[model samples]
Target: MPRHDGGEKPQRSCLACRETRDRDRLIRFVLSPQGEVVPDLDAKLPGRGAYTCIDAACLAAAVKQRQFGRAFKREVAVPTPDEMTAQVAKLLLERVMGYIALANKAGKIVAGGSMVGDALKSKNKPGLVLVARDVSEAIGEKIAAQAAGNNVPCRWVLTKDDFGALLGKAPRSAIGIKSSGFVVQLLKTIERYRNFLGEVQ
Candidate 1:
């Protein structure tokens, strides 16, 4: 664990890349009593923890070099590279989904196609536009164009069913996120997810 300065969160080095970053930006792993490497996504587990950037390439390098044993300073059972990647990806996706749900609950999200379009056109523009993956190309393009015109970030990753479920609606083709502190956190989580999947440079 890296030492904290004042009230700032501690920084930790990636076991593979060895690059120091805020602990929240890295994934944490702990050695269980059974010697199994367990992901402590919340970083609340009671044990010595190893850190790794939330990236597939970094994870691959760590697995290839068998760094877990060295990090834990003991013989630990590490999952296969594929399994590890899948597990991490699953956890990240769940987190992103949870954030979307929270934004909706907090009245920070405007769902439904027309509502989102209007929100984008309003003088009080949203900070982000989320289009469902399965949305028609015409609608998606329109939303993207509107967002671009307003200098707002646009993302199309979740399916209609996924977005709808998060918003507690039947199904939505588009949604708008109001500019707020939560939007910043949501965007950061999305970027981390993209990095983990190698979807962005």
Candidate 2:
């Protein structure tokens, strides 16, 4: 008997914005036979997929800089900046929100300081830590130390209010975890480091 299984999803980064957001957080475009840039919202379209962040600013920059050509390694024509940005942003937001819902269902995320602290103390230290800015600096430092000692990455530690609003919920009164904020920050840092690379260049 034949068996069926869902395949693993691969990730790609946006060249223009240098954002390492998940594939879902970015829009995919492919060059059509007519050499027109076509949006591949499903990310299942045939041919090479070039990425751009969902934000209007990043999308505009990507188009202006011909980043799609760099991504596909071929000259291609794209839609108007405003139109493409709107469409891409809408799709990306929906996809990102869906992923968040799935993660919530899987019980992969946690909030609140005391609970998170206990989680860190457990044998299974959390792979990520999200510290709310509202939390005292002393407490934040302590948690950061614990995470560092456990060899876990400290990420997306922002005010609970900010994170909660993004998720369309009442204040979680904590931080965000396994979030794109960490990815964006990491990408920015990498870009800065790369810029200084071979300064002898």
Top TM-score: which candidate number? 1
Off by over 4 Å in 2: 1-27, 31-42, 47-62, 65-97, 132-139, 157-159, 162-170, 173-201
lDDT of 1 by residue, 40-157 (tens): 8889999999989989889878977999999888899989988988888888889889988888889899888889889988899999888888999999999899899999999877
lDDT of 2 by residue, 1-201 (tens): 133347634566776768676676566788999888887866798997887664566667788888888777887878777777766555544544444445455565666666667777787665566566576777778777777777766643335675466556666544324444443443343232222221112
Residue 140, candidate 1: how far off, in angstroms? 1.7
Give the runs in model 1 whose Cα sits over 4 Å from its true position: 1-10
lDDT of each: 0.88, 0.61
